[model samples]
Target: MHYLLPARLDLQAHLSAWPPTEVPQFHPDALVRLLHLVTEVPAHNRKLAKQIRQQGGYVPLSAQLLQSIERHYNHYLTYAVRSGLLETDGRWWPTTAQVAGKCRGYRFTAAYCTPHPDASSDEVARQPRLQLVHLTDPKMQAKARRQGRRPTLLSPAERRDLRLREQPHAPLLEWLAPNRTPLRLDQAAALAYLAERFDMLPPVVAPRPKWPEWRPKWLKALDRDYYASPVEQYNQRLHSIVRLANRQLQPSIDTTVGRLHTTLTNMSSELRPFVYADGYGPLVSIDLVNSQPYLANLLWNPAFYTKSSSVKSTINFQNFRQSEIYKGRNVKGIIKEIPDIMLVNISQLTHREDIRLFSSFTGSGQFYELLLNAFRQRDVTLTTRKEVKELVFQVLFTRNGYYSPYKALFCLLFPTVDHIFRLLKQQDHTLLPRLLQALEAYLFLHVISRRVARTWPQVPLFTVHDSLVVPQEYAGQVEQIVREELRQATGIEPTLKHEQWSQAVRHDLLPPTSVASSIELNKKNR
Candidate 1:
């Protein structure tokens, strides 16, 4: 059974004829936008049209103008398909069914030919064609009309209200390719078990938690909903987790905005504990400690190299690996101090005595507390350990030569660590955040994911950026494997932390009530 797949149409040739007859007014800007939407990005036809209309400035595209444009667009497709210039299967996946593995619409095969008037026949024949896809379905046409009637933009207040009402969830629109290899039997069973448990789980109905007083002003301004009621925010996260679990699980990578965003990776930390494999016990999460800063330290370690002509050595590298830093410190304590020590070393300041004093404070392994005390001494109004940690993150994640607006605060807090930011930008023109992200992806996909697949083939391992969630029994082995992989990949010893489901459950940390119960309570209260 052969399907009549759509071939590309030569619209440019028809439009560029010597004396054009009844060619529709297809604006160049509109055509370009349409081509981008269909071929490159690949959105639904109605969505593509709405996006084009929304782009119009001053006065938005009028209903009549929009209708006319869509009409011409549809007419072009119809004519091309009918005349055999363009081909199609004459069938379409319904808009509702498109999410369920029916993504195929009209695909672009060839370009529209715009022959030069002075050019020979050979030149005309050699004209390159544009490859594009077009959707020509009655349902899509109806959807477009409905969407046109809807308002495109919302006021700030309306947007805030909408955010409050709707659950905050990343879109789970990506579908795995059908031709991709299937998951192993064990892997498939584990995923299926997790999916079932996730679907059956109830929503959380907990007491509203206090908002963090030390949250950055900028972050507070951006996500008011999160700050307003942390418990409600958590409930929304639970709903998102359920939705993510409901998605089709397969061994395929889905990328968005140059980063991997697969269904498993997108699961929030709050929801990870609830994930379970049938035969294996509840999941445990093991994550790299201070992963981004660790990478940055690795990148800029050479800057601290000493040249005495007789013998050359790096002070930072040697100090970092020394047991003296961890003398009284446990893993967590050592991890917490690494950022501050790295900052002091990387800054390349002239005041070596002051740097040494700051290093002593960091080496105390109570960096955040001491840093907060230092800020208080300088009259810099920082309250919590979290706030100090956020400040450290702000410095570490700063991009290519661009000083954060919070520079004054950071400089006042850590007076001698200003040069480290400049050195990071000098080391790489590309921003540290992007470089760190690429490295993280490489580490997760290449090292961690592969190791899990090979060593514990039956175990259901999931990734969340720098962390991996696996069965609790295998947590120690997984952590060891991850550390070994990181050492092999970057030659840096990695610090690891684990969160067990048993611990969380024993502490009554997981939300006590199910979603259905929460909904019922809300109804009763109303």
Candidate 2:
């Protein structure tokens, strides 16, 4: 009996020409479904609609995406467009063209539905209830099922799915809901300040240089996969952040990797200054310096993996190596020996000078700088810390078979560490990033956030991956706690950096000509 329908009426009556039994053209429910879809971006939420308007107010619609919902979607869409119920905008290009087919932006015509004017609280409450699209009719339900669509939202499972789509995950929902401990946002004030200055900053896309034949092979793959340039991607993310701010609702949250993904985390570093912790006033973010490399240092110790939530392998190293040897594996050849060779390497890990140096670099928060300096020494094309960091990530996260001269230099510098990285990726290339992210989530979410909440019940806490966001007043105490927890967990003193969330991005703070320069400038300013 449960169904989702548009809150307002479609005054155009676009499907009136078609009879109920019509075929190969418009169905009786065609207009209703199209209205349902066209209005789907805002979903009857006025705040969401206003926010979406900041991003040009169009919904990206593709024949491929629509066809996934039903087979005859094209005809239905064409009918709606010709009937003047819908209008098309320019083509929508996503980050990658391969992941999605051609998409055309679409929005509902004013003839389709009347816009609701801003009303007072009493007037809003007095408004009529949303009209429901009931599939109580057996024929309608059967037709929906035939199209591989949901027939009813009556079931508990269906309702649950709907709720999830409307709100955030359970734990994040509890934190965001209207309560004493609400995760508040001073969005109205923030957006007003941001809107005045955001458009002034021109997009600063980096120039794409032609790939030299002698360049690293992985660079080719990376460039090929990314359809848009760095600045274009940055602008895209910036617009999205602006749209998110316009909502003025509870910020959306994702519990992916056990981390809270709010608008704060999603926005560019340049835009971070405008947002605050609502009633608690201005906030500060304490970032874990060289988070990934620092976390990877833990992998050097065999005992860490057993205790890690993401990687809990208790296999005996000696037995594992013996088994590999017994299976006629080439034990003498390091690369061909075993994927779990890190286990065997742990015995002599402490003796390696390179391992000790790597630990020192990560601990002192100079991992990226160290790589940058080394790449510069080798006269590699990389110039900034950002480029060096990306190169290192590609090497660490990409498949072991991926060829790169930069990776070769890394191997030359830290033979033991590079060997461990190759061994870790032998089984699955994705294991490294996934394991590191999981460890990061455990460290920040389970360890730091939990400890902070337990100690200071009044302080509002949020997370941006490896970093922790709290009010400025409690920063020192929180920093101390973070330091203690990290050292206790990893047995290494980590370098932590703090950045305050301000109300504006100053003139000098404007993004520079290239992403690399912008990053370097931001680092220096921080």
Candidate 3:
């Protein structure tokens, strides 16, 4: 069915044209490369054309690559269309850029283009086939290979230990998986509703704030590659949301694997708000305050840890008591009587000199600020509070432990992280990272997922590790549920924080008779 017919279509032969004129002859590989580049950015076709024209150095296209691209772009599109690899509505690529007319653009029918496997192996292949040939420059390929071979800082033993915990707990994974039949159907309906009204939705606001000049070098480097520009990142997120919505609306899960190929969990924070529930309003995110730190408080508490044989049971007990906050007088009395038990236990275990300061710092409900203050007190010359906080987390989460770049600065400035690391080492030298992952899994499976299933089954929910997102109207109820569920699961009451889109933003995005307005109108009518 392919239309581009030639007796022998040699991609290499057309790489360079004989007489370098304004219009360059097109090569199939060059066209494929152009498509791949445009697909990566997906902002504008002309912009991508411009980039290809201006590109220099190794693997530079024929001198007239831009002219060639513009001339034969339609031919390439026709080939892609005939090959069943792309679909477009004949509009310029839909982007957040405030350009006048629709720019011509195309989206991939699959995440990646590859040959279809035989029927025997078809069940294992989740991604659909694309006819386009994959192209990569030799230099870029070498660079990628070099990056892949770069030595990890982790010791051999630590690497082996991490591999054991890499596959999440089976029970946890099963619990987190979307319902096989019904959820798939519901997700489909919800996705369709959202997609139909997508244009009406408010433009996604830029979620990240301006970075300070003194941001951590590591953080800046990471962002430089993947998220060079916040606006571009925001645009990519918007596209991802639409793509996810499309996939979820259809059933894309692998029954044999019992997992979805696409999930809402990986979506950026900014896009979560746009995930509309079938009949509900916009989602409001509710999160546990200092979730990991709070869990650490319970895990390392001297009174609880010493008395309890099972860590899981102790966590359950804590959560149970937390659920009873303000409801049960006995629970309240117990908390009032031993309010500082967690703080005291952690302080003693860490051998921190300032127990009162630590308690006050934890009580202030600003975990990162506590790290910043501790670092400042130690005369660390960090450029910003954010830097200190990021440095501390980088140290704590690093599997390579002290080998991490931020280790020295963090260990010297904040004793708490060092204490936690040392304590985990005493338990088992290779257990620190695994323990952290396990704790996170426990919170997600036992606390958040369970609570959502039991209490808010009717309300659509999405998670971002420690936080939960639900409709804005249900924020108060969901907050209380989260607090109680966490208390029941961990025996500690954690402060919660929430953010919502403004009513104006919501109104602009949502239909006039959307759930938000309908609920308000109904209340007024009553």
Question: Residue 362 of model 3: what lDDT?
Answer: 47
RMSD of each: 20.1, 14.8, 17.4
Misplaced by over 4 Å in model 2 are 1-173, 178-256, 305-340, 374-382, 505-526
lDDT of candidate 1 at residue 11, scale 0 to 100 = 46
Score residue 201 of candidate 1 by CA lDDT. Answer: 51
Candidate 2 per-residue C-alpha lDDT over 413-471 given as tens digits, one digit per residue, 9 for 90 to 100: 88988888777788878667765675675567655777777666556677888998876
lDDT of each: 0.42, 0.55, 0.43
Error of 2 at 411 (Å): 0.6
Per-model TM-score, in order, reads 0.42, 0.57, 0.47
lDDT for model 1 comes to 0.42
Per-candidate total of colliding backbone pairs: 10, 0, 11
Candidate 2 has which clashing residue pairs, if any?
A: none
Candidate 2 vs candidate 3: the lDDT winner is 2
Best by TM-score: 2
Decide which is better by TM-score, 1 or 2. Answer: 2
Preferred candidate (lDDT higher): 1 or 3 = 3
Q: In model 1, where is the ten-residue run with the lowest total lDDT?
A: 166-175
lDDT of 1 by residue, 194-242 (tens): 4455455544322212333333433433233222122223323433333
